[model samples]
Target: MTAEVCEIVITAPDAEWAADFTRTLVETRLAACGHQTPIRSIYRWDGAVHDNAETRIALHTQLIHADEILRLTNQSHPYKVPCFLVQPILSASPDYGTWIIDCTTRPEAI
Candidate 1:
C-alpha cells in the first residue's frame, strides 16, 4: 500500500522568515519541497481584531515527517504561536507521490 503525502502549511511574519524556515526543513530532509507567498491575515489576538501581512509556506512531504516539522517550526518560529496546518494530499499523481516519499524518507540510523 502507498503512504499518504501531506502538504504542511505554515504562516509566518514575512518572506524572509518563511524562506529561512523552509530552508532548514528541506536541508534536514524533513520536507521534500516548499513554496512561499505573502498573505494578508485577519484574526483576533489578545482580545482585539487585527489585520496583518504574513507569509505562507507550503511544504510537500510524506505524512511520517509531520511531527518533526511541527516540532522544529515551533522551536524556531518567532511568533508566540505559529500557524502550522497539515493537509493530506489524497490525489497526487503516482509519480509525484513516490517523489515525496523518496525525498522525505528518514535516513537510517547508524
Candidate 2:
C-alpha cells in the first residue's frame, strides 16, 4: 500500500535555527527528512509590510505526524507567528512513501 505522506513547510529566522528545528523533528520521529534553503520573505503583519531573509525547511513525513509538528512549532518557533504549511503529497515512489511512514511511526507512550 502507498502510505500517506506530506511536505511541511516552515520558515526560520536563520540557518542555525532551521537546522536545530529540523533536527528536533527528525530526532523525535516526527519527520523522515528536511530540506533547507535560503529564502527572502515579504509579508504584511500588524498592519505593516516587511521583508526579511529566512531559511525555509521542507519536511517529509507521514500525514499522521502533522498535528504534533504544529504543536511543537507553536511552542518553540522564534517568531510570534511562524509559517507552517502542510501540503499533501498526492504521489510518491512506493519505496520512498513507505520509508516516510516507517521513519515517522513510533511505539505509543506507556
Q: Please report, as a residue range, the 10-residue window in candidate 1 with the lowest summed lDDT.
A: 101-110
Q: What is the C-alpha lDDT profile of model 1 across 39-71, one tens digit per residue? A: 999999999998999999999997878998888
Candidate 1 yields a Cα-based lDDT of 0.87
Clashes per model (N, Cα, C within 3 A): 0, 0
Taking every candidate in turn, the Cα RMSD to the unseen true structure, in Å, is 1.7, 1.9
Off by over 4 Å in 2: 1-3
lDDT over C-alpha atoms for residue 30 of model 2: 92
* Candidate 1 Cα outliers beyond 4 Å, as residue runs: 1-3
**Model 2's lDDT to the true fold?**
0.91
